[model samples]
Target: MPKKERKRLQVVISDEQDALLTRTAYELSSPERLISKSEVVRLAIEKIARELGEGEHLEEYRAILETEEVGEEEA
Candidate 1:
């Protein structure tokens, strides 16, 4: 089987968010398997997408994202 191309997503997150990701990844890591920040993000995205099923609350999600962006800018 051929390897599939994966898209890259780059975004600037607040220091608090970075810390949380680092901590979560660390806690989820084990001797047999290690979790990374990227993995944590992927897992989070999967969970959110699953919970939002069918995109019924898409607008609410967009509004929250917009509010977070504004809040970051004002900080």
Candidate 2:
């Protein structure tokens, strides 16, 4: 017999963040098609873990921040 799937849990978001999430979901296709916000947050945590694992090297993070700043300035 096949293994049974686990049940899903519910999460609550603030009204402002919820609106942004919905807008993002629509832009990325449909909310149903996109992964859950929890999953997205988990992936972000994994990325941070990988970055920190590279000890004494923060250049990557610095570059990312610089790029964001530049984009904001342009905007």
Candidate 3:
């Protein structure tokens, strides 16, 4: 827990996903690279937020038409 105020969150996952997360956390852990199941869930949440633009974490994908126009002008 950092200085920031934290809220407890509860989530439900399938048995398979739970097992996978446990395995991943164990494999990723080390003296220098310690990871936890909670970290995995937080990472997943951040990825989903970026992909869904729940915030401006990532810009909308560039349009193919815009890319083609830029390439034509450069050429």
Across 1-75, the per-residue lDDT of candidate 3 in tens digits comes to 679887999866557879999998988789899899999888877786777676543434346447656866785
Query: Could you give candidate 2's per-residue lDDT for residues 1-75 as a string of tens digits?
Result: 999985676755457767776665456556557766555555655878777887634787789779867866785
Per-model TM values vs. the true structure = 0.75, 0.40, 0.56
The 0-to-1 C-alpha lDDT of every candidate, in the order given, reads 0.92, 0.67, 0.75
What TM-score quantifies how close candidate 3 is to the native fold?
A: 0.56
Comparing 1 with 3 on TM-score, the higher-scoring candidate is: 1
Q: List the residue pairs that clash in candidate 2.
A: none
When 1 and 3 are scored with lDDT, the better candidate is: 1
The collision pairs in model 1 are none
Go through the candidates in order and give the C-alpha RMSD of each one to the true structure.
2.6, 8.5, 12.8
How far off is model 1, as Cα RMSD?
Answer: 2.6
- Candidate 2 positional error at 57, Å: 5.6
**Poorest lDDT segment (10 consecutive residues) of candidate 2:** 23-32
- lDDT order of candidates, top first: 1, 3, 2
